[model samples]
Target chain A: MLADGLRRALTLLLRGDPEVLGIAALSIRVALVATLLACLIGVPIGFAIGTTRFRGRRTALTVLNTMLAFPTVLVGLLVWLLLARSGPLGGLGLLYTWWAIVLAEIVLAAPIAAALTAAAVQGIDPRVRRTALTLGAPAWRVHWVVAREVRFALLSAVVVSFGRVLAEVGAAMIVGGNIRHQTRTLTTAVALATSQGDFSLAIALGLVLLALALTVNVLLHMLQGRGDAGAA
Target chain B: MLALRDVTHEYLGRVVADIPALDLPAGTTTALVGPNGSGKSTVLRLLAAVEAPSRGVLELHGRAVRSSAERLHARRAVTLVEQHPLLFDMTVAANLTDALRLRGARRVDGRQISEALELVGAGSLAARPARALSGGEAQRVAIARALLLAPQVLLLDEPLSAADRAAREALGNVLAALRDRGTVVCLSSHVLEEAYRWSSRIFTLVDGRLEGMTPENLFRVDLPPGTGSREVRVGPLRFSIVTDRSGPAIIAVPPEDILVSRTPLDSSALNQFPGRLTAISEDGHGRIRLAVDVGVELITRITPASLSRLELQVGTGVVLSFKAVAVRVF
Candidate 1:
């Protein structure tokens, strides 16, 4: 079975199927855009959660952690409801578009990024932050210093979220409609290929997904190790 | 000059820190000594700008600041070092470079790094990967980094707990030099002896309240051995000393003044005890720490040659004797 799958996957890649290549490219573009958006929104929230001493901080943290476990299909369903015709955001006409998948992925990954960033910042010695503030690290710099100290963790969060976005099928299919050569990602491609009994194509997409995940994990593992060493 | 006016803090509606008023003048090393949970670290945190006083104003050079941003501007002039030296995962040189980056002293800072390292006697380990360095070495690197920042005020929280005697002494000198350079240094420690030795003025914290103690107060003990009309007991294993009179007393010795012998010495040393040895450990130098059991537990430091000659072990019985004159009556 493995030999047959590999042979068929190799044959599809050599053939350079437009649908396959287009879907892979689109997946990369959407996941990157979504991850960047998540970071921009997530880092500040993480910083706020990290340094603030207030009521409901714990509640806010608990909610974010709970959201981390929210399944992909659930996110897809919620976004589908909001962007589908006759829904609240239906007038925007984002349904069945690339942006719909991007929007859904952003929502999916934001909480993961935010919660991990918060954890990383919180792991820093409280005294270190105080020292930075006292030593003239403008309050903004205090946030930055603490954030930078946890940069590796934040990177890992992004990578983990990226991995989730790359592998996410339910949301991309529902929101993007798996549009031919327009919105189909590797995951959507894999699902369509399997449904059509094109097992070779599906296996190829799976290989690419596994490679991407491994690359991210390796890079982040190196960075996190260095950061931990520095911390020691 | 650092001044706190009626600073008060509460957590979950319970007051955890309260100080009526205090001034930490420039260029003096003030040691804040207290037991655990006494708010020593909290006071350092407040001064470090990691915390805000719930009800009081903190004035630095007679300025008023409201937000953490403003406080950070003030903090640039004061640098705080935590009890555990938080070293970055990098080369020692890189960590020192970050400290320089903060002060905008890029060119001349490298030389200052070496100077700071030399002051702490860890100059030889400059190029070492920081993670591979020992606890004491890492602390010295941290001190070097803090000094490179050259803040007008320095706050240290139990910074020498991991250091050996030589390193501690070296770091003590470095701090003294900083004091001489006119840096207002506030240091906290759980050990009173360290505070007594290094601080010209001492502030003690008890149950979240701050109180000042004079230099003499640290040394003030009831019935130190040398003073006239005082009596105390020194037990090697068993607490079997029958004093001339019983009252508040202390068994004081110069530590180095203790003489160890295999046989009962005929010396006129007034205090002596015969005890089985409990443990023998060296402080990595010529000196050895001997825990001997006489009437009561006693610690004796003797030369390595004597230790080897006597062949001390956990069950070895030896005579622990010290001179009365060496004991100073409080």
Candidate 2:
């Protein structure tokens, strides 16, 4: 079966299937939107967690930390329930749409961003905060300085979050329905190709996924190196 | 002026700081002296608004900071240079400009940055990354960051205490200049002599409670002959100036004022302690430092020849004597 699947994937790639290319492009577009949304929402939350010292801060921090390990299928299930027909957001008809896939991916990536950013901020000493405050930096300016200083970590967070969301199959397959020429993404495409015994197509998608993951990891490593150098 | 009216802070439900009505004068350097865990840092934090008072009220220029936002604004008027310089993970220029930016000073000139750096003798370090700085340089940068904001009050939580004498002296001069510029500088030091030299007023924290808010006054003790201060018995080795009045106090005695004798000798010096020798080490010069403990352990620097002539040992006994006149009760 594996040999037959490999032959099918090689032939599909040789044929240069437009449907496969479209699915790949749509996947990238959805993942980009989701990651961008996550960045917007998660950066500020991460900044708050990193810098604030309010009551229940620790509890809030712990919750975010715990959410970092949220399984993709569970996130997909939760989003499914929220956006499903007869669900709270059912009237939006977002299920199996690119928007629904994007929404699910955002949910998958946000906690990663928040958790990483929080750790980055917490790594900073209170003395720096005190220094910033005493320097007459208003609260907002204080947050900005902290965020800028921890930018490398934030970038690494974004990369890791993007990788996590892009590689998630359950959310995309469930929310996007792996629809052809519509909501299919890299992970869902690989799964569908594998199921259909289209091994060449699956192999090509697997390579892309591996490349995407590797690129994110390399970027993360570089950002981390810069962070260490800055700290040093 | 930063004033505290019975400011108290607790940690683990126990009182870490309990200052009773401290009125720190603006445009002068005051040193808070105490042993470890004595709430010295707590006092600075309160003035800086880093920590809220657990019970009593703290007023900056007669206004109470009621909320965190208010405190942030109040804190802007004051800068705290902590014991560990707390350098930001950014360029020196960025760290210096951070406060100005926070104040919304977008057009802050390079001249001002250079001026602040020069004030701290850190002009060359403007481009240096904060994390790459040595301990002393980082402290200077911290000071520069504080001063660039031109804060009304400067709280240094033993900023230079951990540094070498050269660094401490440089920092002291910078602080002295800040105080001269009408900035209220509050410095904490565990070393009394260093604190005495820099602070116009000296306050000592006793057992988590602040005491001795007296202006430094020079007092002389006259010792009788053959009564070397070294021979006098003391309960503890703690150098405590027993004073009658309070506002700020100072003790001044040259090393020459200390008269050491192997045997009990009569002298004009009134204070004497029977010190057990712990370590006899030589100061670079002709001076020798005898680590002695009578009631409290102390290090007394005497002449090298005197050390040898007396045959001082790690376990030997000696009489530590200093004239009452020599012991200036601040």
User: Per-residue alpha-carbon lDDT of model 1 for A56-168, expressed as tens digits?
Assistant: 99999999888888888889999999998999999999999999999999988899889888888877777566545544555565666777777778788888878878888
Q: Candidate 2 lDDT, tens digit per residue, B91-125?
A: 89987776677788868788999988887788899
- In the range B181-273, model 1's lDDT, one tens digit per residue, is 899888887676788687777887765678532222122223333424344433222222223433443333444666888888898776777
DockQ of each: 0.29, 0.46
Provide the lowest-lDDT 10-residue window in model 2 chain B: B215-224
Query: What's the lDDT for all of these models?
Result: 0.75, 0.76
After TM-score superposition, the amount by which residue A49's alpha carbon in candidate 1 deviates from its true location, in angstroms, is 2.2
Reference-based lDDT, residue B126, model 1: 83
